[model samples]
Target chain A: MTIAEQVGAPRIVPGRGIPYPCGDPNLPPAAERQWRRQLVQRALDAVAVAVEHPTIFEVDDVNA
Target chain B: MRIVHYVNQFYAGLGGEDSAGIGARVLKGTVGPGRLLAQLLGAEHDIVATLVCGDDHAASHTTAAPELLKMAQAAGADLLVAGPAFGSGRYGLACARLAAVAQAAGLPALAAMHPDNPGISEAGDAPVIAAGATAREMRPSVQRLAAAVTKLAAGEALTAADGRVIQAARVGQLVEQRAAARAVELVLRRLGGDREATEVPVGGFGVVDPAAPVDKAASVTVALVTEGAVVPAGNPDRLESARASRWLRYPVEGADTLASGAWESVDGGFATTAANADPNRLLPLDAARALEREGAIGRLHGEFLTTVGNGTPVATARRFGVEWAAQLRKAGVQAAILTAT
Candidate 1:
C-alpha cells in the first residue's frame, strides 16, 4: 500500500495481504467467495470513480 | 596491469559509416585512442589487445561480448576498458554490454561515455566515467578512463569526484556522523531556511492524469493483471520467481475459476501456500467470472497478464505497466484490475 501511494496509482484498492490478496481461506467456502466478490466489486467501483490523486478505495467502505 | 580495449570500427580506423557492418576481430596491441590511454596509464599498464567491432554488428550480435571477452581472457588481460564512446549510441551500448560481461566474468572493467548515453542504464554496476558528447573530448575522456582503470585495478572505490557516472545501485558508505545525527542536523538546517539540505533527494513519479470514470461500467470489458506471479502448474514460460524482466499472458477464456492443482503463485517475496491452495486468491478469476455472468461487467478480457514483482526495479515495473497497458488497449480492454503482491 505504501508503494502504491509512493508510485501515485490513480485508483487504488487495498488488498488483504502478501499471501492471499483477494480471498480469505479461513472463511467458509461460500462466505469466502462472497468476500472475494465484494473485493472485486470494490475494485470495479474504484475504476468507475474519478479521483484527483492516489485515493484508497477501502473494501469495508463498500457499504459505507 | 594487462588491459583489453574495445572500440568501434570508426575508432579502430577501419572505415566510416560504410564499415558499420564489419564483425568483431582482435588486434595485438594499442589502436587509435588506446595509444593515448596507454600513454596516460604510463609504464604500469600494457594494452595487451584491442577488440574492434562495427557499431551495427555490436548492437545486433548477442555473442560478440562473450567471444571478445574470451579472447581478452586468453590474452591474460587483467582489466577491460571499453570506449570513450561519447555520444555514439550503438558504440556506447556495445561498451556498456562489454563492461557488464567483463565484470560478470570477474574482470575489473570500466567504460567512458556521455552521461546521457542510453547504454548507461545497461552498464550494471560497472564504473562509467562521464565523458563529453563527441570525439572532440577524446583526450580528457581517455585520461579519465585511465585514472578510473588504475583505481579499479587497485581494488579502490571510485567516487563522484572521479567523474564516474552515478550508477543506479545505491552503495553503502561510512560517513563521519551517525544517521541520527545527520537526520537531526538536516532537520535543523531545513528549519533554519536551508530548504535544499536534504540527505537524499527524492525524484517524483511524474503526474499522470487520471482516466475519466467509466461512464457505464456494465458495458465495458475489464481485464485482470497481476504482479503476483500466477502461472500454469509448471510455469511453461519459465516466469522468474523474483525480479522478473518480462511478463506473460495466459488465456482465461471460458474458464470460470482457476483450479488449485492447475495454477500456482511463484512470487518469491511471500509465502505462496495460501495462493497455491487457491490460485484465485491471487488472481480472483472466479470472482471476475461471477461478475461477468452477473452482467456487472460486459466482458472479462480473455487473457490475464502475469509477472513476478518481488524485488523488481521501479523502472522495470513501469516498463511492464506501459507495455501491458498498450496490449490491453489493443485488445479493447476499457479498464483493468491490477492485483499486486
Candidate 2:
C-alpha cells in the first residue's frame, strides 16, 4: 500500500515486491507476468475510484 | 536530453558515512549508478556530469540544493536524476529535496527512495520512484528510476509505482486476499493459492495551516478539548472505548468544574480509576473556571470535546477533525487547548 500522500495522488498497492521487484520470484516466468499484470490493473482501478478514507485495495493473484 | 545527476559520496566511491561531512563536488562523467542510468537511458540522453555530495552536507547544510541547481544550470541540463537513496534517511531526504530544488529551477526532475524514507514527504509531485529498502536491490531500483526518467523525457504521467512519492501517507498494509482477487470481489478466488493483502492504502490527509496565533489569547474564547475519552459517568454518548470515530461535547456552563462523581474518565486504553476519582485531572474544568474567574481569559467554551485517540485510523481521525473544526468555527471558538493521551 503506497498511500500516495507524497504525490497527493491515489493510493497504490503494488502487490508484493520490494524497492523494485514488480512480481513474485516464486512464480514461473509466465505466472509472474500474470501476477504482475493483475497488480498493475488493480492499481489503475484503485486510482480510478474516488476514495475519501484511506483504503486498502486487494490485488488478485492468478486463478487457482 | 542533457541530464544532471546527483549521487552521494558513498555511491560516487568517495566513502561512506565517514565521509558524510564533506562538501559538494562535480565530476565530468558518470560514476556509480550514473553509469547504469546512462546505459538505461541509452544514447538519446547525455549524462552531463554527476554532482557528488556528502549526505550530511546535503541534509544539514543549505548549500546542497543550490549547488546541484547551479551545476544543472551550468551544464544546460534538460533533466535531473537524484538518488535511489534506499533506506538511508539523510541521503533519501537529500535526494528528494534536491530534486525539488532542481524542479523549482524549472528543470524536469525525479528521485527514488525506499518507500519508508522521510524524504518521500519532501517529494511533492516532483516524481519519486519507490526503491528497495537497501542498496542490495539497486539493480532493480536503478531500472525503475530509469523507467521514471524515461517517462519524464517523453512527458508522460508517472504512476505511484513508477515515480509517485507517497508524501505524508503511511505506505502499504497487508490484508488477507488472493492474488486473483485484485479488485473488489467477495467471491472466493486465488492466484496459486496465495493469500494476504499486506498494504493498506491511505488517502491524502488534509493539512490545515495553523490558525495565525490568536491575536490575543487572553481576549479570545478558548475551549479545552481532550482525546483521552473523558466523559460523564456511564458514557452517555456511548463513545467507543477504542478506535473512537466520534466526539462528544459536555457543557460546563454555570459550573466551575466537572464533578468527579457526576463525570468520569472511561478510556479503555487506560485505567480510569484515577480520573474517575478526579474528573478535573483530565478535563481540568475547575482550573479552567479559575482562569475565567480571574479574567485570565475572556471565557471558556461551555462544552469541551473529547474522543479516544488510540488506534484511530488516519481517515477516521481526519473526519473527526474536519467535522469538529466546522462546529467549533460556528460556535466562535477562537482557540483551543487540546490534550491527547
Candidate 3:
C-alpha cells in the first residue's frame, strides 16, 4: 500500500505520474487550470470534516 | 567513521501500523537499513550504529533525545543522520528536533523530508537535510546523504549536495563578510570624525534638538520609550509566537503613568507593569512629565510606534525598526530614552 493509503490519508489527487508530480505536461493551460481547481476542491472538502482511512479518487481523468 | 541514523518504527524494520507502537532501540553492530546506506557509500563511509525509535515514543516523550544521544555515544559515531521522513508529521518533527540537538552538541547532522513537510523549514539550517520521503524508497536519497556525510567526514569542502537545496545556513551565527565590513569602514572614514569608524558598531537613532536644551528652572521632557508593547489586554494582537512576530507603534495621550496594576503583559517576553503604573507606556504623559523634570528629553511625541518585539524574525525586526524610526522622524520626536521593564 502507498503511504497515503497506509496512513489512512484523507484524500489523494493524482498528478501527471511524473517524478516532478505537478501538472500534466501535454495538456493546455485552461485544462490544467480546471484540473488544479478540481484538486483544490477535493482538498477543501476533506478538511471541512475529520476523516479516517484512505479516500482516493481521480481529480482530473482526461478519459472521464 | 562511526555514524548514527534515526528513523520511525516503520522504517527501522518494525512492521507497519501495528508495530508503530514499538519503543526506542539502539542497534550496536548494524541495523538493517544502515546496511543500505553503508553499501551506497562503497568504502567512502561506514555506518557505526543505528538509533531507531517509534514516532509516538519520540513525540510523547520529550526525553527521547537523551536516549538517542546515549545510543550515538555508545556507537562511537562522529556524525548523526535522521530520516528523510517524507511528509510524516510526527516523524519529521522527531528527526528535525534530534538533528538540531546533535548539531548544537558539535556534531555534523543531516535529515531528510519532502519540501512540503513543515519540518523542512522548522529544522533551520544547522543540520543539513536532503530531500526524502518514504522508507521503502531509500536508495537514491541514502546515496545522496552518504555523499554529503562523506565529504564532511573527509574534511573536504562541499558545495550543496545533489538533493539538498541551499538555505544560507540560517543557524543564527552572523558571520561578518570582509568586503561589506571594509565598505562600511571606507564610508565612515569619508565622514571624518575622531571615531575609529571601521570597527565600532553603529548606534540607534536619536532625536534632533527640536526646541533646544531647556534650563533647569523650565519644564524638561522625560520620554519613557518602549519597544512597541501596545497590545490590548490579553494581547488581542496575538503577536507573540516564539518564532515569528512583528512590532506595531501606538499613540498615547498625556499621562504621567498608567494606573497601577491596570495593564498586563501577555505574549511579550519582557516584563510588564499594570497599564496604569507603567512609565514606559509609549507617550506616557506621566512618564514624560517625570522625564521633563529629569531633563531626559525636551518634548514627547504625541504618538508612539507600536509593534511586537518578542522573538521577531531578524529581517522583520530590521524592517520594523527602520519604519518606526522613520515615523518618529516624521513626528518631530526629540531625544527619548527607551525603557524596558
For model 3, residues B1-341, the per-residue Cα lDDT tens digits are 77788877777677764554456787755566567777876775667777888765565455776678767877777888887677565677668767777777777777777654544544544445465556556776677777777776787655564466455433554556777777776787777664554544533322221223224212332223444354445556565534344554444556454443443344345434323233223323443445444554445565544554455554444434333443443344433333222
DockQ of every candidate? 0.54, 0.01, 0.01
Can you give the lDDT of residue B230 in candidate 2? 79
Model 1 spans > 4 angstroms off: A1-3, A60-64, B1-204
Per-model TM values vs. the true structure: 0.55, 0.44, 0.44
Instruction: Give me the displacement of residue B9 in model 3, in angstroms.
Output: 0.7
Number of the predicted model whose TM-score against the real structure is largest? 1
Best by DockQ: 1
Candidate 1 per-residue lDDT, tens place, B41-144, comes to 98988999999988767765668788888888988989999999997767887898899899898998988999867666668768899998899998888888
lDDT score, residue B164, model 1?
Answer: 93
Candidate number with greatest lDDT: 1
Evaluate model 3 with DockQ and give the value.
0.01
Candidate 2: fraction of native contacts reproduced: 0.00
Residue B57 error, candidate 2, Å: 1.1
